[model samples]
Target: MADRTITLLIVDDHPVVRDGLRGMFASAPGFEVLAEAADGREAVALATRLRPDVVLMDLRMPGGGGVEAITELGRLGLPSKVLVLTTYDTDSDTIPAIEAGATGYLLKDAPRDELFTAVRAAAEGRTVLSPAIASRLVSRVRSPHGGSLSAREREVIRLVARGTGNREIAAELFISEATVKTHLTHIYAKLGVKDRAAAVAAAYDRGILG
Candidate 1:
């Protein structure tokens, strides 16, 4: 059987990064660069139109961030898979991207062969993570607290620690007040607390918030 070509949409804020990725994929067999987007919003629009096999997403951008775009794509029930290609591997970056429905996470420093392999795996609907990211995830899972706060939850808690109300947090995060409340509830449960104050305290104690 012939190998299938996997179509990709490359998204990054830097023009050079996009050019490099496009060039790299163009030189590789069994891959096609269908389009490129400079930020998350454009990435979503193009992905929605092209329905590519995979989306190479950057985590942070001015227009929109990768996690929000991933969430939107999942909500829209698009068939394309998202593979995060970013420099950040912190808990704040990794956990939320996975939660938002990324098929894989790879750092910019990944070897060319490794990136190609990860893109192929993502196209096959498999979960792929770099060695460092995999190790971090393993550590989180093995921690005594089975649940770790997602990036959004951490944001909400950080605001709560500063005495920010639900409405303000909703405004800041561009989410609904109800969503903010829901995140608070999840934070409380994850931190073994019963309310916002306790949740904030617990988060600080656990170094989830600075």
Candidate 2:
């Protein structure tokens, strides 16, 4: 028996960042840098080809963004786990990436040991979030308004506000019509509204829609 090596694909727009990560991982044991990509598109292509155990993804690349890439990977049914390693921890960045099927989210400033642990956890299909991001999510979930809407629920409500039907939302989000209905149900309960119209109005009033 032997310790398994965790394969990784590092995705970042900056070449210097990529080089640094490669070097850092190269110096560590029980890890292998399979390849590197400068943007999400390249990341997806390389992941498809290499089928690495985990992908160290960056959020705001020029050619393609991490959330879109994560969504595409899910749609394509790739088994690679995406661990977002980005500088941004705002709600806008964390929520979408998590909803898009990222296995973990970690800050770029994370210590080497913490990053390694997160990667190992992600490779094992565990969810990981940085302390700041986790606190933000906890506060959002514990908000006084029944409960704050999840990222998918927010997407559904936004579509509802625009008069998009369940079928259209399902198609757009790549979910089934039944899933869309379920999200709407949860959204209504969270917003303290019973119907689509009221839910949309509540979302607007509560500043969740903007």
Candidate 3:
């Protein structure tokens, strides 16, 4: 390992979850817990101020919540790599978190070793996902239409299905926000679904990509 430690910010609404994560990282070598936040808005604020190497964010929170927070961070050009830590494992959650500039996603119940690996990968700006989660997501996209959407469109759909906003999607895909919107417009037109939620549901039914 390098001499420098990996700095982290933990964001979750539940005190126990945040405390547990903090404690977990505290015991691990080459890791440092720089700060904590209880919701998405606070996460954005704390990340802007602390500028940690990585953020472990929860997906669901009220009031400009988790995914939106990621979007906000990208809008401000913060360098923190987001690693989503949430209980939700469905395509609905995984795709959006990634779309919202998350370097990876992990379940709340993941083993300590996996979490440690994931955090390190995230810190290095790599996308990480539990094997099972990855398999499910890939299958979800691949099962439908078997390749109906273009790669970029599929990327847009995957993130859209996961509930990510255009800004987050753009950051994750390394595209401009306007371009992301354009992709969505095409996706919506092709999928014949008016909104992201519907596009996600339709993708699953049709097997367009997953």
Q: Give lDDT tens digits, candidate 1, residues 16-120.
A: 999999999999899999999987789999999999999999988766778788989999999999999999998878987898899999999999999999999
Candidate 2: which stretches are off by over 4 Å? 144-210
Residue pairs with backbone atoms closer than 3 Å in model 2 (clashes):
none
- Predictions: Cα RMSD each: 3.5, 5.8, 7.3
lDDT of 1 at 122: 93
Q: What is the C-alpha lDDT of each candidate?
A: 0.88, 0.88, 0.82
Per-prediction TM-score, please? Answer: 0.81, 0.72, 0.70
**Considering summed lDDT, which 10 consecutive residues are worst modelled in model 3?**
143-152
- List the candidate 1 regions with Cα displacement exceeding 4 Å: 146-152, 163-182, 188-210
Q: Best TM-score goes to which candidate?
A: 1
lDDT of residue 20 for candidate 2 = 96
For residues 1-210, what per-residue lDDT tens digits would candidate 3 score against the true structure? Answer: 256899999998889999999999999899999998988889989999999999999877644457778878988999999998888786646766677788888887889998999988888888899777889878766676533565568878888777888888866754557767877787888878898888898889888646
Model 2 Cα RMSD, 1 decimal: 5.8
